[model samples]
Target: MSLLKEAFERFAPDYLERYGQSMLPSHRRCLTDISSCQTDALDGSLHVCQSCGHEHYTFHSCGNRSCIKCHHLRTDKWLDKQQDNILPTRHFHYIVTLPSELRPIMCSNQKKSYKILMTSAFDALQKLASDPKHLGGKIGAIAVLHTWSRAMIDHPHVHMMIPAGAYNKDDDTWIRGREKFLVPIDALKSIFRAIFMKRMRKALPKQIFPQAIWKKKWSIHINTFDSKVENLLNYLGRYVYRIAITENRVLAVSQTTVTINHNGEALHLRGEEFIRRYLQHVLPKGFHKVRYFGIMHSAHKQTRNRIKLLLMNEVIIPDRPVKKKSTRCLKCSSTLILSISVLAPRNFNCQASVHPP
Candidate 1:
């Protein structure tokens, strides 16, 4: 069994008992799904090996997006889909981070705050890139929201992958930004700060503290991505469907303590403390962590088609490996046949198998 599954099973009840009153419905759902994931609480499919006449039970997965066991297949599919959308041009990697003082506000209002974060960042990039001094064209940006630091602290930031050029509507051509630069860092920072503050203030509660954050200089970091699409996809796969804590990172989970490797440093935490920190990153239901804006927006089908045709002659994006379906037996190396499909018992053990008649 996975270490994460064990941790959740052991500590989730205590964590819920103490903090259930304050937890969001989404948080509860995430915990329950993860705890029951691949367990008998979900369901199981009875399979029989055709050659060995061996009968075994395979439990159903919760299919929760945050479940580490479930995200690998989704991540691969997402990466493959992105290959078609990757523009054949230079791209820039930009990071927009919120002021530390606003972390509490963002945590309470995750959906609204995260939406504002992406919108403000994309607005800033599009506005600056359209200026004649920069590139004077409409740019495309794909931003992914991440809420945790290496230490699992609440660090809200958006990582944007932007094409380092723009499509000039009037000239009907693509105008590339400077080979090494996308926009002036100072100018981008100012615009992002203004827009984010304006939107966030409206969404925030009326009685929140620390108005001094308004005076702070928000961070806007930019770096040119000179690598190919393959490298970018590989890097993005790590974060695309990542959970707060994967099973591998969990070193040991005892009755009262959990140990993890945080940035190569070992840190031990109370079981309830670990669950609390991990669940903090569980996003609200129906909230999208990754979004596309400007020329890459999903609504701009015609525009994307035009851009694809314009850049059709460029280097082709290599096709992703096709995922093989799970139809074969692992132990006997024979095709397995589904025999029975029904809801599983609450305490059925997955390791126990029924012998063939």
Candidate 2:
């Protein structure tokens, strides 16, 4: 069992009993799923070895996006799908962060706030890139939302990967950006802040925000990468299907406390507090944390193809070797054949049987 799952099994019951009524349905579901993941609470399949006739029963995973036990395959599949659409040019990585003062409000209104944050950030980028002083053409971007800091604090931000160029549809030409700089950081910050505040007001009319946040400078980081976008995409893929914490990061889980390794430092928290922090990062049901905009949008596939054709000689995406799964039997070192079964009950168990022909 994963340390995270063990921690949840130990602490989730008491936490839920104390605060179940106030918890979001998604959070409640996450707790149940993680606690029962890859266990008898879920279904299982039977596998038989071809050589030694060893029968192994494997339980199904919870499939919950927040569950660390699941989504490894899903993340790989996402990266493979994105590889085809990646532009063959230098890209800029942008991190747009929500101010500390707005975290409470954002957490309270998760779905709405997260959606607004992503769109607002992309809108600012599009607005700036379209100006004649800048690239002056339509730019494509992939924006991903992250809600947790290294210490599992609620820090909302969007990471955007944008190719350092634009595609002008009018003339069917590609306009490359400067080698290092994409846009002025100060100007981008101003535009992003104004757009986010305006959208927040329109989305939450009744909520009042502190005026000081408007005056204070928001944190925005811009990083430049060469034509190889695989690294950037891989970094973004890590957060797409998983939640704040992972099983490997969990150092120890005792009856009363959970300890995690954060930035090489051990941080301990009470079991209940650990559960609280983990649940806080479970996004609302059906909320998409990764989004595409402008030319990167699915609707603009034709445009992207044209851009790729124009930059075919210059584009260089490294060959990504697919990681194959091991199907060999552990007991006999022979091939294992799988046969999926219908959903089984909690007590369901499979005895050793011959391999089915």
Candidate 3:
């Protein structure tokens, strides 16, 4: 049996009410989808061990995306899909972020402005790389938007994957960027800040746009990138499906607040109202914060295919098959056999698609 089963058995009615049933409209729909996927009970009898006299029965998981007991399989599948997309070379990991002051604007203007930010950032990188003095080529990047900090605060930022080469349009040459430096940090920071702020101004109504954010001069930091591509790819793969806050992060949840120890120092933090605000900022319905750009962009597959061929350079990454991890019961010294079940399609994706968002 799994940990979920143990919890359900011990907790019974309360557990059933909380996780067994659906809450929101989306939840109800997902539950319905999962119900369609489950096989009938098929008339099985409970069994008991003769010597130990232990009895056990069987039940099923809702297989909903939001359910903690579920989604592990789905997360694994997503990780598999991304591993195929990684290219050979020293890849760099970069985080593009807006100042805390600009978060409210980001919240109000979610879809359009967010896309604009990605576009502007991407454009800046491409332009800087294409310059003969800089790198002189088109850079490939995968950008992911992260809206929350460790404690669930509304911190908007973009994590990017930049391989160290570009298709030089000018000379029609494959120019590898400086291994030590992909793009000049100061130059990228300057260009990215201007492009993002400019696009942001265009996204909002003139009346509501804040003059301070628009007019003021602020330093937007563009940090150093990683030298190893494999390291960067693995780092990105783990964070793709990150939850707002996990079990270990929750130090304590009082009647009025949830105390999250980010650094694990066990600091006692409080403020009921603040906690509410933090949770409230946890992404509204159908909001997709993660996105892909460059060759990975949905509409630009033609360009992506061209770039993929160029990056190959007769070098191929071996397909290392992934196997299930160790199968062991946590509480007792016992081996566990895993069963595979094809579940009814769940509404895990944003907009109720076939895949996770």
Best by lDDT: 2
**Residue range with the least summed lDDT across 10 consecutive positions in model 3:** 348-357
User: Which digits, one per residue and each the tens of the lDDT, describe model 2 over residues 284-351?
Assistant: 88899999999999999999999999998885989678786666665876765666676767787644
Q: lDDT, candidate 1, residue 280?
A: 85
The parts of candidate 3 lying over 4 Å away from their true place are 1-69, 169-172, 214-228, 253-257, 267-287, 298-321, 325-357
* Ranking according to TM-score, highest score first: 2, 1, 3
Error of 1 at 225 (Å): 2.3
* Tens digits of lDDT, candidate 3, 3-60: 3223222333332355544444553443343332222322222323333443332234
Q: Which pairs of residues clash in candidate 2, taking residues 3 or more apart in a chain or in different chains?
A: none
In TM-score terms, candidate 3 sits at: 0.66
What TM-score, computed on C-alpha atoms, does each candidate reach? 0.90, 0.94, 0.66
Greater-lDDT candidate between 1 and 3 = 1
For candidate 3, what is the lDDT? 0.55
**Regarding TM-score, does 1 or 2 come out ahead?**
2
Q: Compared with the true structure, what per-residue lDDT tens digits does model 1 show for residues 59-78?
A: 77788777655667678778
